[model samples]
Target: MSFSVNKTIAQINERIRKGKAVVLNAEEMTEAVKRMGKEKAAREVDVVTTGTFSPMCSSGMLFNTGQPGPQTIKTAKVWLNNVPAYAGIAAVDAYLGATEPSEDDPLNKVYPGQFKYGGGHVIEDLLAGRSINLKAQAYGTDCYPSKLQERVVSLADLPYAQLLNPRNCYQNYNAAINTTKRIIYTYMGPLKPNMQNVNYATAGKLSPLLNDPLFRTIGLGTKIFLGGGVGWVLGAGTQHVAKPQRTERGLPLSAAGTLMLKGDMKGMNSRYIRGLSFLGYGCTIAVGVAIPIPILNEEIAWFTGVDDSDILMPVKDYGRDYPNCDFKTIQHLNFADLKSGEVEIMGNKVPSVPLTSYAMSLECANTLKSWIEKGDFLLTEAQEAIPAG
Candidate 1:
């Protein structure tokens, strides 16, 4: 059966009017789906909350760093606590990429995994009320001329430090392992060679997009709990693949739909959004995101009901370049099997590591519930449907 957006909105409004809007968290919804059945669950449940906490390499922060340093310094190079921040923009404005490593000690050939600090970590430090050393350099010029600048900056010091993530919650992701003999530093984290370990991002069955499957209930303008504060879906994120191999339920057999998210970094704390440095690998940002899914109809209910067994991810070789073309040779495993801590690949029980934090994700969902209950947030419809791949 098809879902009606207008009808769903009315149902939600009525429940809100009656002060009985039933909002269920991810764990609760999973059980509700099984016990109440899709039809009944759809009829009763007003909202299904989904959450995930994972490393997003595409995340960055735009900062206003208080005032322009002594003299009108047009910052050409910027670094915060050894990590690089983009400072080529207008004076005093800067953007720090999550994956940017320090110039002095970057993720390189000699000691690839030795970096203890990254752009993400610098952000975390600044959020924790710690002062970060800021240094910038520029060529002496007739206007806004300053060759050097240095100071300490904190979140309190900057009026604007917005979390502008070009990409965040991926629709899906692959489980990566190394088939080669050498260890590989990858975006999915270090992959152990010879199928030693499989690393996967996303909370698997608990991810937001995984529940929605099709973006009917989630799209641009969907308000989400992002890095501890409210954020909105701007549009399709970078590398968005609208279509991928799908199962009978329309859930992808691999990574699919993605979201471009933006939020105010000033209102956030280090508790939810943390900066991380991968040994020998570059820096990456870990963001917490959660959304409320309206049970528009039975189909949505069924989609929300998808459990670990319903989701499958391809185990690919991270040793090779990304978008690995040899996907046919990759083994697909269900989240249920993957969640077992180990999965038998080629008759060998290989340990699996979740790159996403389930605990943080649950916190995000519950936090959103509190927001809805407090009437601080509401569901919104996308102005336009997300385009297909």
Candidate 2:
């Protein structure tokens, strides 16, 4: 990411000066010069071509093409080098300050009448195939059956006999019971099923009855029930209550439950959760690129060895077309001007070409030059750089 302005310029100058010069036969000097011009053109083209391909050399390549202004080149270089660090810093900040609730925080609400613990249980049940039902209650409506009615109704109107039913009686017997036996169900309800005293005893036994061959074929989970169909059932005598499982859509819970579930908690229990973090890492990098920042954009272009054509094109359009036009394209166009001691981009001094089109030209030039220098007209030095597959 670091760059020395003086060092870069010096290296460029030295390369140009040290490059071998062509000597031609006197009889064909015209032809030789033409050939030399073509060769030089080709060499210059090669430099332009490879420069475009060179990672972190976008600004350098652009200069060879005579397109970008000095300011644009400078700005691009600065931009490219700074993006990764900026993104890294931002990522660290986000990772440290992510404010969502932790897995164990019971207060974190996911969905109405749904607690994080319950959501996890639901996931586990879905995996293990123990009977699971999620009853979604409309707010302010009587969703709980009559068993929970008493909990919602005022106890002041309850008769002594009705309040003192032995099965429902409690320490605050009179106050606790009501005309009806319904209970108050909140979004934060526990994962355990709510049932009347009579229902509770029978509900536990239902699991065993459901193990019958007739019921075993249908899946006994929340999704199956909500979707209005029976699904495959788990084997009878499955002692363990199901635990939560991870999926792409996230924890199968209400909104409140989702909030209560922690990313770290998933990391601890599931291998799938670990993979999510890696996926997030890649997403974070992509987000960093999408964020608007001038220097960072340039830095990306430099690292990729591509021009910030989106930014550079307007600047290049104002420049005039030159005779040897191959080099004056893309980010390289600007760099070409810089090498010629034109510190300023004035009027129409820059060159304009389609980003893709210019890239091809630079690529051809570099390929030709590489072939001449490396004695392989068909293969580029870059191609040679690659190890045999």
Candidate 3:
């Protein structure tokens, strides 16, 4: 016998009352599945925590830098650390994206701007309680007559700076390599030529959506640890493509589900969430997210038993350009072989290292476990699974 949402919640609440609810992180749940099997594991483990720490370029933050001047300023332009914050909104409200580079960055003459101090880095500074310079301009009006405004601001001075990312955790990702004899700078970090290096993302076996697979227990309104603070799965993210090919185990062979999460940037820890400057490339934010999967049924338990071998991703040759690059020919390999630190590609043994931080992912998972143990967090029934596209 297994459980429904209400039944599982009741058991969890009762256990909490007795100060003995069983909680396990992804790694622990995987082990419990092997030792106790699906049935026992389903009944014994209340929640399974999953984490990912990687650069999510789709991330951004919205801030309420309160009206600083006596005259209302309908900000026509906004800049935070040289990065343009979208001023299309109201006067003092703007959104800064991780990948958004500054206007002055192009003058550096690099093919790709090394946005060392862009909006992403600005967020890190704000979290660190460091003062960041903010400048805005608006044509003077009859009532709201404010031509220009500028100031230094900190997180404490604002109402809240919310990190609302349209796409955060990707279901899966490619392990990239450059076959041509030329060094390339792409989003997956700099690629050394002639398959000299392989950079892979994704938490592999420990990824959240992969653990749930079919989105059975991960959906809208599901509470998650996002950017070091609690957030919810708002809805299906852009390009949440339910791909055609999937393993017999039901996990996608390509990137499938995506998540849009938002949380208060004020309460988040700077350590788990960070910003980066890719030397010749643009800026990116390394966001940490954790999802707690409720073991509501035997099917859920079966899904949670998934391992590195069950998850596979493409090894793309980034040397090609445009539409051809989109349809580039390559092999799909299991995360198990990728985790081995080497993979045989075209008879050439290539060394592979994860650009994403698995160690930090584990730490994020463990941190969520402590929250559950301390009764600081509780699971909410996922509103609805991500439907087939």
Each candidate's TM vs. the true structure?
Answer: 0.91, 0.13, 0.94
lDDT of 1 by residue, 178-248 (tens): 87898888777888778899888878667898888788778888878888888888988998888787899
Per-residue CA lDDT of model 3 for 1-389, tens digit only, reads 43542337667756755668888889888888889888888778877889889888899998877786777888888888678889888867889988787777753556544556567788888888888778888887886688888888888887768989999789887778887788988888888989998888988767888898778777889888887788889877887976647888788877778888888988798887788877667788899999988877767887888888888888888777421647554888789888889988888999897888999998888888888888888888777778644
Model 1 bad stretches (over 4 Å): 1-6, 10-18, 66-70, 106-113, 140-143, 320-329
lDDT of each: 0.81, 0.18, 0.81
lDDT of 2 by residue, 1-389 (tens): 44221122233233434553221111122232234443333222212111111000000000011112111111111111011101122111101111111233343343332222322232222223344321111112233121111011111211210100001000000001011233432111111122211100000001111111111111221011100111111111112112222122111111011000111121111111111011111100000000000111222112112222111111111112211242232221222232232323332232211111223223323333443344222111111110101
Candidates ranked, most accurate by lDDT first: 3, 1, 2
The model with the greatest TM-score is 3
- Candidate 1 at 80: error in angstroms? 1.8
As for candidate 1, its clashing pairs are 112-280, 113-279, 113-280, 114-280, 120-275, 121-275, 172-255
Among these predictions, the greatest lDDT belongs to 3
TM-score for candidate 2, residues paired by index: 0.13
Pick the winner on TM-score between candidates 1 and 2: 1
Residue 162 CA displacement from its true place in model 2, Å: 80
TM-score of 3: 0.94
